[model samples]
Target chain A: MNRIVIGRYIPGNSFLYRMDPRTKLIAMILLMVSVFLIQSFIHMLVALLLVALLLVFGGISVKRVYLGLRPLVFLLIFTFLFQVLFNRQGDLLYSLELHYTVLNLSIAMALVIMWGFTKRFLRFRLLYFLATVAGVFLLFHYLPFGIVLGEGTFSVYEQGLSTAFFIMVRLVIIITLSTILTITTKPTDLNLGLESILRPLRILRINAEEIAMIIAISLRYIPTLLDEANKIMLAQASRGVDFQEGKLKDKVIQVVSLLVPMFIISFQRSDDLANAMETRSFVPGQKRTRLHILHWSGLDTTALAFTCAALIGVILLRVVGW
Target chain B: MNMIDIENLSFTYGGKVEALKNVSLCVKKGEWVTILGHNGSGKSTLAKLIVGLLKPQKGTIRVDGVELSERTVHDIRKKVGIVFQNPDNQFVGVTVRDDIAFGLENLRIPREEMIERIEHYAKRVDMYSYLNKEPQALSGGQKQRVAIAGILAMRTEVIIFDEATSMLDPDGRKRILSYMRKLRDDGVTVVTITHDMREAVQSDRIVVLKDGEILKADKSEDVLKDKETLEKSNLELLLPLEVLHGLEHKKSTNEEIKEFLWQLSLNG
Candidate 1:
């Protein structure tokens, strides 16, 4: 529950940190759009090069970059596997044959069980996952102890592999770009940038300042309320309320018992917050000053112009079917 | 002139029940006043009313010579800040620095000055290093200090602590009381609303409230020594301290009082 990968900042002295938050936000969006415009190997290579350049300039080590992608490893693998196995539009590069027998199946199951047991005890989990896969495949191929239950053959296509590779690369680049943005930018600075971006909404009679204040306050309270919920859960657990293991009906009741108190406390908290805000002389939608004044320097302008040009170039590439 | 002056103040919570009834009180400038009451005795309500968070249905409440009303409430709030009870709920910023700037932003302070005041007040409260820290990363006492810093940054002449130390530990309570003493010494009017008798004993004046009415208002020693009125308001007297005060007013010493108490018990 505590493993939040995004919106977490690490203090550093780097060019990205010096850039205006608005510039970073806009540049990140533009980069994401350019990433999606990749149509062939050339575009993919270009995008990969840009992401690598950003990684270097971000002052983040390769290990930290891998750590950033750790949470999405499963999704990346799933996408690759789904594309390779299901999408067959090109000539077959290789034919794969498989047999399922009692001996091999049992051995595979044992390997899986072993992996699960040793997962927490191991440090290099990616290597463990790969090792387990190799062990299962070798067992299925070389060992034959009982009657074969089933046999099948599947073909791997050239196009499917290419497409999967492109997709996985795109996802990693996008996620890594976003991770860099969140790491470099402060949350308060991001809020200020969002308010600035949403300033034109004032023409629609929507107060962007009030919306920003709401978002800021909500972000401020998220950890606090989560702690409160944890406390409530523990208190309920001590009272013989089964939260983790119970019948479905009993679990639902337990959840309700937890949620009702949380809701009551949140409501009372909102009341208290409203009164406190009033006492602080906060009037929503009123003209108020800010503490961290965002200055859009010439360098920030140049950065945004560069990203905008990159976005336009990518769009042109897509339009020309490159 | 009184820092806070309330006359014939009456407040009902949207016609639910009367929280304060015809309450009248005067707090002198730079006075450290503690309002003592049990739960539901309208102590918090009075704090809110003075800060203009709640309107008095039938009375005039003035702060720093300005009457609190719809037109002047904002100005009054700028002059009189509050440190509420709950540290989590009242935290309006994502970080200590931002939270302290919250009130300054509302007051339309310039960016440079806001930073200066935030640093000044945060240092004063010993939270300078926690400026970039989130409220969740802080203990209850630290969060309270940040909350107080937020109020102090507003440069309010009068500060109200509405049961601010109720949720803290002994050390936290003592730390906050010392800050209160410092603020009063700096000529800032401090009104602390609390149910702790020990805290009331340290204030410059004590105003005991009962059923939304001021039962007794006197100097701290006088009010805490008045066992009859304090008991009527569900309060207690620090008897040993009172006996010492009795000696203060006369030529008696601690040994003599001990001897007399021993004789009385023997006779009984």
Candidate 2:
């Protein structure tokens, strides 16, 4: 559950945290655009370094940034493999004959080996996945028990590696920068920033304020809904609904039981909330003043100016074909 | 002048279930009143009605001399604020300070004044240290205290606790009750909707509701002494109150009754 800290804000008074949310938001957008625009690995590395410096200045720990990236490990690995395997333009690093039957053993022995590997894979997924990938390549190189079905080769292209590395760095930096933004900015300020950024859409009759309110309420309710769902799950577990250990059918039933009650509770809660909001004079689409009026400080101005200058530099490099 | 005045209040749920029927009550300015009832006894409905959260089918509710209606609800709400039963559900903000500022924000209070009120009320509820803490991180009692602080920040003349302590433990309940006492002492009108006889005993007056109608409304001690009315409402006397009631024939003073209970506990 702690791993679901993507949208949760950690209160702080660091330079990045104290700068206006509008500045942070604009910087995030410019940095994200710059990350995608940088094609060369060196440029990507520079972008990553800039993000790293921002993280340092923001008082965010490397461990926290790494934890934020944990959920993306599989995506990173998948993209890396996709690039490595599919990009056939690369020069061959090694070649081998892939045999149809690598295991020259009795059925019982094969079943035992398969079972052992399956257990290990289930227990240590990431490590086992890497090990299995390595073992498959090793088997292709070394095994000579059966006839070869086809020629298999491992290749690493200069172009593919550079592209893959650039993509990976871009993704890591974007995610880290965005995480830092959310970690520093409070939800309410984020809502206000979004509203202000999108205020131009109001001329197109888009109701930006209402949209911002929706985002703000959704952000506020995420933790609350998670807590409620947790309580419902625990209650169902107490009633012998084994969510962790059960057949698919049993798990479905357990999920349904938890979800149904949660939906009902949420509906009731929304009703009460509507009444409460109404009593508190929260009229939809009506103009309301804020208690925390966002003011642009000199720090915000400097931060925005730096971000724009960096963005211009990235653009200049691209235009000049650096 | 009446802080809150209700005349023949009747409310139905979706025109089918009657939640309250022909109930009327009044609280004088700065008075402490407890509305006591069992579950499904219309106590919460009455509280909501007074706070203008629910419209009555037939009745007039006035808070600070302003009649409660759709047009006047916003103004009425300024005069009266309610702290609801579920602390988690009622909380609209992620953190304690944000929640306390919520009402003040709606009222359009200036940022500096909102901050001052937040600090003052948070300190009043002894939640100053946890002002930045998320509502989920707080205990049930702490959350309720934060809710109270939010309402207190509104600076409403009439404050309603609609089963606010029902979800809390004994210690939390005591802590909230003490706050209610403090509010009363500060000349704020307090109306606590509760089924807890112990809490009712501490109020200046008690209005007992049964089956959506007012069964009895009187001084707290008089209401506590009415065994028939208490039994009819399915309200039980607190243990000490029960003991005190048993010695009513002996005409014992409250201090003497307390002394006897202490001696009885010592003997045990």
Number of backbone collisions per candidate, in order?
A: 0, 0
Query: Which residues of candidate 1, in runs, are more than 4 Å off?
Result: A1-5, A99-155, A229-265, B12-18, B57-60, B64-67, B128-137, B242-268
Could you estimate the TM-score for every candidate? 0.84, 0.88
Give all candidates' CA lDDT scores.
0.86, 0.83
Worst 10 residues of 1 chain B by lDDT: B242-251
TM-score (0 to 1) for chain B of model 2: 0.91
TM-score of 1: 0.84
Docking class of 1: medium
Worst 10 residues of 1 chain A by lDDT: A1-10
- Candidate no. 2 TM-score: 0.88
Poorest 10 consecutive residues by lDDT, candidate 2 chain A = A99-108
State the lDDT of candidate 2 residue by residue for B69-158, as single tens digits.
888887888888888888777777767988888888888888888999999999999999999888768999999999899889889898
Give me the runs in candidate 2 sitting further than 4 Å from their true place: A11-14, A87-96, A102-124, A147-163, A207-209, A240-242, A245-251, B244-268
TM-score of chain B of each: 0.89, 0.91
Give the per-residue lDDT digits (tens) of candidate 2, residues A1-322.
Answer: 6478687688787897888888889989998898888876678777777788888877988887788898888999889778776666656654454444435223324544665558543866776667756676666566646644455566666656666777778889888988898899888788889999999998899999889877877787887888888888888778877777677898888888988988998898888777666656567777765766688999998888888888898889999998
